[model samples]
Target: MPNRCQRLLAAILLFAAPVHAETLLCHVTYGGETQDLEARPVSSPYTVPVQPIGSYFLFRIVFQKEPADLAAIKLYVFADRDSGPLPIQQATHPYPPLAGKGAGFGFTGLNQVYEPIRDGELQYWCEWSPSSGPAR
Candidate 1:
């Protein structure tokens, strides 16, 4: 039947389409305020931008999905200094994170990053979503 043939074709097309990159959502807290940062996969890790948090911290997230086998997600925390941003902490998680919904992946708990010089604290946690689109 033509209807059956059309359905088969549609299924094939769906499976053949490229996989959508996952989205990373990070909640960063500082100075009694919280900010949400969202990161999508990038071809080049160097292109990721640093986000300033309050007056003493900077944050960055890098998501990579290429080379399939080497895909990963990374989080960076920095101390905002007069000279420049200095790296304080780095966290990495493999692609297609095993930990499912709710539990989340990378830096799951209340992770506290400290700035040694000023004794400032930055708290953060991250979660991963299968896709950027709305739930089906």
Candidate 2:
């Protein structure tokens, strides 16, 4: 009698956990190279690595979901001269079936990042850009 009740309670609790319906994959292209990373669903944004300030990079984002519902992804840009980085620009895009690409505007600074709303791993590298040279 008691064992039967315990089993039923355990089954109910297991099904009560929240589940994510989608997964986002982001790829940062910089210095003629590309980086593939996974994004997390959280409030705080994850900073991705590119070249130093004045350099240019591109982002390739892919959206995958089970039910194929409507969703959106936001990108946050931050920059700094000597002090810490500050938010400069923020842009959001609707998640497409395939993927999307984004680029940093022509600017100069340090610790420049393209942060996503979800969690993702960031990679940094040194490369040359036509718009601006590598950071000093």
Q: Highest TM-score: which candidate?
A: 1
Report the Cα lDDT for candidate 1: 0.80
TM-score of 1: 0.74
RMSD (CA, Å), each prediction:
6.0, 13.9
**Which pairs in model 2 have colliding backbones?**
40-118, 40-119
State how far residue 29 of model 2 sits from its true place (Å).
Answer: 1.3
Which portions of model 1 show Cα errors greater than 4 Å? 1-21, 100-107, 133-136
lDDT (10s digit) by residue, model 2, range 1-136? 5698899998998998655433444334444556544443433233434223223333322222223353445554454434555555544554432221223311111223553432333343221222222312
TM-score of 2: 0.34
Best-fitting candidate, measured by lDDT? 1
Clash counts per candidate, in order, are 0, 2
The deviation in Å at residue 73 for candidate 1 is 0.5
Give candidate 2 misplaced runs (Cα > 4 Å): 1-21, 43-72, 94-136
User: Across residues 21-121, which tens digit of lDDT does each residue of candidate 1 receive?
Assistant: 56788889898998988888898898899999988888998889987876888889988888988898998777866563344434355688888977778
